[model samples]
Target: MKTVFSPLHAGHSGNVELIAGAIVPAFEKPSRAEFIRARVESEKLGPILPPEIHDLAAARKVHASDYIDFLPTVWPLWEASGRSGSAIPFTWPTRGLRGDVRPNGIDALLGFYSFDGGATFVKGTWDAIKSSYDVALTAAALVKAGEPSAFALCRPPGHHAGAAFMGGYCFINNAAVAAQWFRDHGAGRVSILDVDYHHGNGTQEIFYRRGDVQVLNLHGDPMTEYPFFLGHADERGEGDGEGFNDNYPMPFGTGWDAWNASLEDACTRLSAYAPDVVVVSLGVDTFEKDPISQFKLKTGDYPRIGRRIARLGLPTLFVMEGGYAVEEIGINAVGVLTGFEDR
Candidate 1:
């Protein structure tokens, strides 16, 4: 598998996020990508290439244009407001509040564009965000060009972002952008399988009203997990997408055997969907040692997940998502790729 990566991911480093009722350093740092890159080279899994530059045309397909316009303005607005450290939002308009109105104040605008404070920004954040988007597009292009599979090593992981709001350390939804790219280019049908520990609320929301792109996520149940809304068994799509969307929400202590059963069911549905291409939102946070997540998957189990996906016999694109256990991230994430190659 050829891997797409970028040095600009380093620019997204050193930001803080609001979690657990306190603000602290972000766990989604640049080192996570570096470790995975190193393993890809050490394992001699195909070439690692820099991404081709891309515009927001592909991203605009799934994300709102106003939300895309808000990201680049964050740092400038922060500096004008005389703020110093990472730009984090502290408030939100919930329930009966008027979210329709866009505010002029920097703090208010931040709250308006974001669901939570996790998608914090620093001066170099926009540059990093663009680079991650480029990485995803370039990798999708490879699969579209006839490669069996490719890896997009995206940072500031994107599963938590939605059409108009950013959260969960994600800015642009890379996997969603890539899935849309496939659909726009030439694909008759596309499917996204998000294996991230957290539910891919953003991806599901983007495709929930459309039947063309099938979105499936297997993650921690929303009742006890981060991004604690949606991701239930009953969220089956609304209109043309009614029976297309699927969610496998497992409890806190889920391990390999139980998780594999869910994957088996998802793959069976994926085969039935018969998409022209598959996009895997590969996140290793399900590993037992992952700090921010609560699944018990061991290093050896990742390959099994890959092998099962490989059995579906379709072109695949792996877009990196979450995995805060920096030390073991490479082994687990690459294990999936190697497992697929072995199959």
Candidate 2:
């Protein structure tokens, strides 16, 4: 497995969060990737390096030109609002409105690009997100090169960002970007397996009407999850994409026994489809003790999760996703990789 790294992630760190009704230290830290890399080294896991940018064509295959341009500039405009140093949005746009137009001002622009309150665009936010996208594209190239696995240690995880919007601390939808690249190059079919604690609403939205790319998510029930708008068991894909999408919304207090069953079912569907490539939106937020999540998965269960996925033996790319048990995130994430290696 090749690991994707980026120093630009360090510049994206800033605290502006709401927890327990108080703005406090940001749970989504840039150091998450840093620590993950440290763990990769200490474990003596495998080779690690930052991916060389594979040209913006692959990224443009998934994101819009306007949105891509807006990505790095949102913060500068937000900062130009004349508040303090950096700015965060308090309100967001909702459904029923046509989202065809891009708002130019910061306030309206925030609604245009982001969906929720968990994310903020500091001066460096776009730079960090662009760097993250580069890292993902670089890792995707490894998949094209026939590497069985490549870990893109991306921050401000991208599973929550769709083609036109961003949320849930994600800005570019890394897995979706990679899957799109896979299709653009030569893969006949691509599947995204998002196992974040919260639903990958953005990734799902991006490929909802597409047949060639299938999106499967095992997440907290939207009824009780962060991205409360989706993740229902009935949300099969629409149109030609019908039956291509799948969601397994496990309840809170769920453990490995139940989660693994859901994973098995997903794998079965993916294997039957015989996708040319598989991408894992690997998030460890379901850890039993995660401060913000409710799933009961222990750290040791991750390797088993890896082994189960490795059984598919398909070319896989693991993109970093949410996991706030910062202390154990690396072990758990890498555990999945090592398990795949053991197989």
Candidate 3:
């Protein structure tokens, strides 16, 4: 497997997120990708390549144009406003609020475009965001060009981001963009399997009304996890997408046994869907040592997850998502890829 990575991700550093009722350093950081890259090299997994330059054309298909426009403007607006710290949204237009209005002030625009406080921005954030998108698109291109599988080592992980809102350290939904890229490039059908600790709420909403792409997620239960509004078992697609979306929401402290059972069922359904290509939203935050997540998956179990996905026997793209256990991230994430190759 060829790995697509970008050093620009280092620019997205020094960010913060609101957790436990106070602001602190974000768990999603640049070292997360570096550690994974080091592991890939030590294991001789594959050659690591820099991302190819890509435009907003592919991302626009998965994200809202206004939201895409809002990204590059974040740093400039913050700098011009004389803000000294990383830009973070503290308010939101919630239920009964006027969601249709767009704010003109920097502070208001931040809140308007973000769903929570986690998607904060530093001066180099915009460049990093664009590079992350480029990384994902380039890896998708590799798979489209006949590579059996590729790993998109994206930073500032993108799963909680929705069509118009950013949150959970995500600015663009990289996996969703890659899935759509496959479809636009002549794939008859495509499926996304998000194995992150948190539900891929953005992915679910992006394809909720379309039947051509299938989205499945295995994560912590929304009732007790981050991004709690979506990921319910009953959130079956709304229109043409009905019955195409599935969620395996496990409770806290879920170990490999129960988790593997859910993975087995999800894979069974994915094989039945029979997509032309598969995109795995690979996240190792389910590792027992992940600080913010509660799953009990150990480093050794990652390969099993990879082997099971390999059973599908379709071209696959592994797009990085969440995984904050910096030191062990590479061992677990690459374990999945090595496992897939072993199969």
> Per-prediction count of colliding residue pairs?
0, 0, 0
Candidate 3 stretches greater than 4 Å from native? none
Tens digits of per-residue lDDT for model 1, 16-66: 999998999999899999999999999999999999998899889999998
Lowest lDDT block of 10, candidate 3: 82-91
**How do the residues 171-224 of candidate 2 rate in per-residue lDDT, one tens digit apiece?**
788889889988888999999998889999988898989899998999999998
lDDT of 2 at 190: 97
What is candidate 1's local distance difference test score?
0.94
lDDT of each: 0.94, 0.84, 0.93
Model 2: per-residue Cα lDDT at residue 41: 89
Residue-level error in angstroms, candidate 3, position 155: 0.7
Clashing pairs in 2: none
Q: What tens digits encode model 3's per-residue C-alpha lDDT throughout 68-169?
A: 999999989898998867899988899999879997988899999888899999989999999999999999999999999999999978888889989999
TM per candidate comes to 0.99, 0.95, 0.99
Q: Which prediction has more favorable TM-score, 2 or 3?
A: 3
TM-score of 3: 0.99
Runs with alpha carbons beyond 4 Å of true place in candidate 1: none
